[model samples]
Each structure stands twice: as C-alpha cells, then as structure tokens.
Target: MTKADLVENVYFRTGFSKKESAEIVETVFELIKQTLEAGDKIKIAGFGNFIVKQKATRRGRNPQTGEEIEISSRKILTFKPSQVLKNAINEGAN
Candidate 1:
C-alpha cells in the first residue's frame, strides 16, 4: 500500500492524530535513510533487515547507441526478509 494508506491504518489502530501519525511515519523513514547513509543496517524482528552494499565499477553498453561505457561504483540499499515474514507470506499464498 501507499504511504498515505499506511499512515491512515496506523492512526486508526493507535488512535493517533493524523498529524502525529504522519510524523511517526516520516520519522521512521528518515531514521532508515539516516542509518543507510551512515553505512549501517537495521533489523526488525519478524520483518526484515535493511543493509547497505557496495557495488564495483563495471563496463556497460548504452542501449540506444550501442556504445560501451564505464559505470561508476556506488552504494546500494537492500532488504532481506526475516524467516518469519517469508513464512507468513508463503502461508498466505497457499
């Protein structure tokens, strides 16, 4: 679901004001971003872990012009689901 949907659900479940719910959601996102920027990881029980990974520079081709180009190295964020979450989804899909 979208961010707004999540905010609404939280507000209803906790009886929090819309403003407070929005702030809570935004704060969570900001903390996640800050942690990633600091090259750290976040793990939540029964959910997942957010990790930062380094990518090496590589050669790539320009799709349109068919020209070779050097792709610069960069850091990327990745998420690995917890076993509990994986099992929950798998059970729901059956």
Candidate 2:
C-alpha cells in the first residue's frame, strides 16, 4: 500500500485522528530513512530485515550506444523477509 493508505490503515486500526495517523506514518518512515542513511540495518521480528550493502565501481556497457562506462560505487538497500513471513505468503498462495 501507498503511504496514504498506510496512514488510513493506521487511522482505522488505532482510532487515531487522520492528522495523527499521517504524522505517525511519516515519523516511522523518517526514522527508517535516517537509519538507512546511517548505514545500519533494521530487522523486525516476523517481518524482514532491511540491509544496506556497498557495491564497488564496475564497468558497464551502454545498452543503446554500446559504449563502456564506469559504474560508480554506491550503497544499496535490500530486504530479506523472515522465514515466518515467507511461510505466511506461501500459505496464502495455496
């Protein structure tokens, strides 16, 4: 769901005011963003882990021009779902 949807969900679930729900969602998102920016990982039980990984510079070819270029190093965010989450998703499919 989108951020607005999240806020709405929170509002309905918690009986919080719409403005308060929005703030809660925004605060949670801001906290997550700040943690990622600090190169730290976030792990939630029965959910998933948010990890930041570093990728070194590499050579890559331009798809259209066929020109080789250097791809700069960067920090990437990745998520690994917990086993519980995986099982829940699989069960839903069945």
Every model's TM-score: 0.92, 0.95
Worst 10 residues of 1 by lDDT: 28-37
**lDDT of each prediction vs. the true structure?**
0.96, 0.98
lDDT by residue for model 2 (1-94), tens: 8999999999999999999999999999999999999999999999999999999999999999999999999999999999999999999999
lDDT score for residue 2 of model 1:
97
Off by over 4 Å in 2: none
- The top-ranked prediction according to TM-score is 2
Clashes per model (N, Cα, C within 3 A): 0, 0
Q: Least lDDT summed over 10 consecutive residues: which range in candidate 2?
A: 1-10
**Model 2 TM-score?**
0.95
